[model samples]
Target: MDTDTPAVSAADSRVRRPPTADERTTLVAFLGWHRETLRVKCAGLTAAQLADRVLSPSGLSLLGLVRHAAETERFWFRTVMAGEPFEGLYAGDGAFDVARADERTVDEAWAAWRREVEFGERFVDEARDLDVAGDEPGEGPVSLRWVLMHLLEEYARHNGHADLLRERLDGVVGL
Candidate 1:
C-alpha cells in the first residue's frame, strides 16, 4: 500500500479508498462530499423542521430530499447497476408526498441513503476495469461513464436544494 494511504480502523473495513486519477477522483470526491453535505444540512433538526413544507410549495423538505435521493440511488444503483427490481422503497409514481413525514420515515430514509452510497462506492470500486454496457433492456442502455457523470450531476443538483433549505432552517451556508 502507498505510505500516504489513510489509515482506517479494522471496524471500518468497508470504507473505500479514493481513486488515484486526479481529475476523475476530483469529480467523484465532489459528489461523495456533497452527499454528506446534504446529510449535514438535515442534522439536528426536528421532525417538524425536517418536514417543513415552506421550503417548497410542492412540500419539498430536507427529509423529503433524503427520501428522494435514497430512492434515486436505489433506482440507479440497484435497478440499473445490479439490474434488480425497481420496486423498492418510495415507488409512489412521482408523488412527492409519498416520502412525507412519519415515525420511522426518517430513519428508513437515512438507512437507504447510506446503503445506496455504499452501493455506489462498490460500483465505482469495480468499475475501473469493466465497461457497463447500455442503460437497460427495454430502456435503451447508457454507458457506465454516463452513469458516473449523471450521478455526480444528480447529487450536485439536489445539494443545491439542500443548500437553500438548510439556509432557511438554521442559516448555515457555503460548505
Candidate 2:
C-alpha cells in the first residue's frame, strides 16, 4: 500500500447494488462487498502502516488480516470446496506473524490474496447449483451454499477488524 495508491471511492467501497433474486447471486454479492470493504480499508497505506499493530498487546494488523483472509479463502474454496490438496500459505506458520513491513512481503501477500479470490470466484461460477457438494476431511461433505455462507461470515468478521485497524492507522472510517 502507498499514500499515492489510487483511492477506492466511497461509492465503490459500499454495497449499494441490490443482490439478484438467486440465492447464490445474493450470497456472492455480499461476500464480494465484504472483500472490497477490506481492500478499501487497506488502500493507500504503506507496507509499514499496513503491518503496524495499532492495538497494543495484539499482533493484529491490516497486513495480517489480508493475509489471513487469503488463507481463509484458500482453505474453504480450494481445499474444501474444490477438494484439492492444500498447503498452508505461510508454511504452517501463523499468517499474522509473517506479515512483515517490506515491499516483497506486501506484494506477495496481495498477489496471493488476489489469486485465491479469483479461484474462489471461478469455482462458484462453474458450480451447477448451490447444492453442489465438496468433501471436507473429517467433516464429510459440505454444500456450496454452506461454504458461501461461511465465507460471507468469515469476511464480514475480518472486515470489522480491518475497519478498526484502518481507523487506528489514519483516522479513516466508514466502509
Candidate 3:
C-alpha cells in the first residue's frame, strides 16, 4: 500500500434511479445509475485497495471492473453502434488483469471509462431512435434498443460482482 494513496469517495455520486420515464429515458437513466454504482463500489480506496483481489478463485478487483466497464462501453456503443474502426483500450484479455496495477493504471482506467461513457451517452442521445441498427460482426444487425437493454444487463451483472468485491476489500457496503 502506498502511503500517498489518496482517499476516494463516491457515496453520493450515483444518479437517482428512474422512477418513471419513457423507454429510452428509463433505459438510459438505469444504465447511468449502474455506471455510478461501479464508482460507488470503488470509493474511498487507494490504487492498492482498488486492485486488491480479496476474492480467491476470482481475479477481480474494483479497478479491474472499471477497466472492463470501459471496454464494454466502447465495444457495444463505439464499435457496434457508431461503427468505428477499432482497437480496444486494453485489447483482448488485458482489461481484467490487474496484477501490476498502480495509481497511474487506476487513473488511466477511470479516464478510459469516462471517455467511453461519454461516447455512449452521446451515441444514445443522437440516434434517430432506438430502432436504429448496427452491423454487429458475429450477430449481424443489432438494434440500438437491444444494445441498450443488453448493456443494462451487462452492468447489472458486473456491478453485482463489484458489490461483492468492494465488501470483501473493505467491508464498506451500500447502494
Which candidate wins on lDDT?
Answer: 3
The Cα RMSD in angstroms, rounded to one decimal, for candidate 3 relative to the true structure is: 3.1
Top of the candidates by TM-score: 3
Q: What digit string (tens of lDDT, one per residue) describes model 3 on residues 23-83?
A: 9899999999888778777767878888888899888888888888999899999889989
* Candidate 1 to truth, TM: 0.76
Q: Once model 3 is optimally superposed onto the true structure by TM-score, how far is the C-alpha of residue 136 displaced, in angstroms?
A: 1.4
lDDT of 1 by residue, 119-144 (tens): 97788677753357545656678666
- RMSDs, each prediction? 7.5, 2.7, 3.1
Model 2: which ten-residue window has the lowest total lDDT? 1-10
Clashes of each: 4, 0, 1
User: RMSD of candidate 1 to the true fold?
Assistant: 7.5
Total backbone clashes of model 1? 4
lDDT of 2 by residue, 1-175 (tens): 4332326343455565464567877888888888877778887777888899998888999889888988988988999998899888976647887446786778788888888999999999999999999888878899999989988898888888888888898898875
